[model samples]
Target: MQMMMAGARTRTTTTMMTTTTTTMMMLRRVWIPVLILMMFGITGGEERTWNTEPAYETQGVNVTVIEGKSAILPCSVHDPTSADNKPVKVVWTDQWSTILTFQDNTIIDDERIHVDHAFAREWNLRINRVKYGDQGIYTCQVNTEPVISYTVHLTVVVAPRLSNDGTGGMLEVMEGSKAELVCNATGIPAPTITWFRKTADMGERRESEFCTGTSIVRRYSSFSQRIGEAGQVLVIHNVTRFCGGIYECVAENGVPPSVRREIQVKVKFMPKISLPSKRISTQKFY
Candidate 1:
């Protein structure tokens, strides 16, 4: 049951005629919606409205997701349920093809990707267990006037893995010059590198014509810190014959299973000449 409140008031309205004629007036009552005052730029509620069209409100933002995680590509619009002129169709796509279609609050199923349209304005696509292959541009389109859509860049980061071509072995340089080595690695968190060198004299000394125990190279420095960073350059400054040894670059990003690359540096130099005393032709006088 509801109750209504009505106020009744009476007012006498008079009008003057040109020929001093009698005036007659009538009373009328009217009601209006108080909430309709703020619509279509109309002011003071004069019972007049302007025609305005609802704008297409589909826009997407870039998203970055880590590997083994999940991500959501957003595609929201205003009054998606209202099919006034054109039925609004929300479709998510990669650079290739359509991923999912949203129609009447229902979406096509693909198991890994699902719709999150709980909020009337939210038309989002969820991707579970994201991987490196999922990194690319994703688009969300609403088949409206002029085709309103949005593009989102999805970046998936994984652990680092060294590539064969990125690792150079048996690198050489001339004496009094500089030596450079490359250690190429691929993965997420894009690995940072540190270089180390193991000398040829690091082996154990044998007494009985053979070595018994194993020798380990435990000393490793963080390199000279002159890494060029494009492929993690390992530099040997002022290369000399003594600088020839095993150079190894280790790449790590706090991810499981760090990658390592090894290179042998051979510093070439001219051999020293030592000759015995030469005998003269005086032997003929004896």
Candidate 2:
């Protein structure tokens, strides 16, 4: 009876140890999946936060200016909260290189270019004495996580100018011959050339007045009639004495200050003489 009791106690002890080991294995199987799921949830949340994009408002613009004038390129940040407690950095660039930069309350040094930070949200660039060479594309960039930028196009306009070579000079044509007059001009928007002819009466009066060097000129004395032609060249078909006078060429565009050039045209013909006695008879060796 004593041996049987001891054997029963040893079996009970082994059964208890086996039950504890089985419970530990089951707990590990359940907790391992739960821990992996928790880790995955934490990593996904972090990725979504990092992938979010900042919200800011900006727009591209077109700027126009006349030559020898000032130009302004505008840029503004509508929502400063997008920076998220970080200082904002701004940079201006052209096709060639960087023009200006603003960071930490400091701006890069440049001649004829500066930031007009009159307002807290404004970062406008001002250019003094703009020239034809300054016309092109300019970019305004902000250093954000993904970077944001705005583009501006600059257009420079110039007034019409007449060329000097063979533009205004005296032109003589024979009777019943064709005559051609040319006027050359250049400008930013391209120039439109118009031809005008002074009337015979006006031409004669202007000539007389000019010869006398008179200051006071008669009204309508310099008036001219349009030739109903537009181009760099004006052609006269079968020219005659009526076509002889002063011609004016006017070049104009949208820009200010139109230009003009004057040309003088003279017509020549054969002279005729009549004799009283069938060609005057001359005495030979009288």
Candidate 2 residue spans exceeding 4 A from truth: 1-58, 80-86, 103-110, 200-222, 272-286
lDDT values of the candidates? 0.58, 0.70
List the pairs of residues colliding in candidate 1.
158-188
Top candidate when judged by lDDT against the true structure: 2
Candidate 2 overall lDDT versus native: 0.70
Model 1 lDDT per residue over 1-286, tens place: 1222222111112223422342221111111211221321234434422133234465456788778888987777776543444434566767775444444332334567777878867777788998788788877766444345688789787777777754347876898887767777877787888765544332311221121112333545422222223347656566656566666678888776777877877778999899999987755553
Query: What is candidate 2's TM-score against the reference?
Result: 0.63
**Tens digits of per-residue lDDT for model 2 on 1-286?**
9999999999999999999999998887666545543432332343322233333355788999989899998888665434245445566777664445443232334477777878767778788899899899988766554456788899999999988856347899997888888899999899899887765565454543322112332225455566647898888877765677787788998898888888998889788688676666686884
Q: Point out the worst 10-residue segment of candidate 2 by lDDT.
A: 210-219
Highest-TM-score candidate: 2
List where candidate 1 sits over 4 angstroms from the true fold.
1-58, 83-88, 104-110, 143-146, 163-182, 188-192, 196-248, 252-286
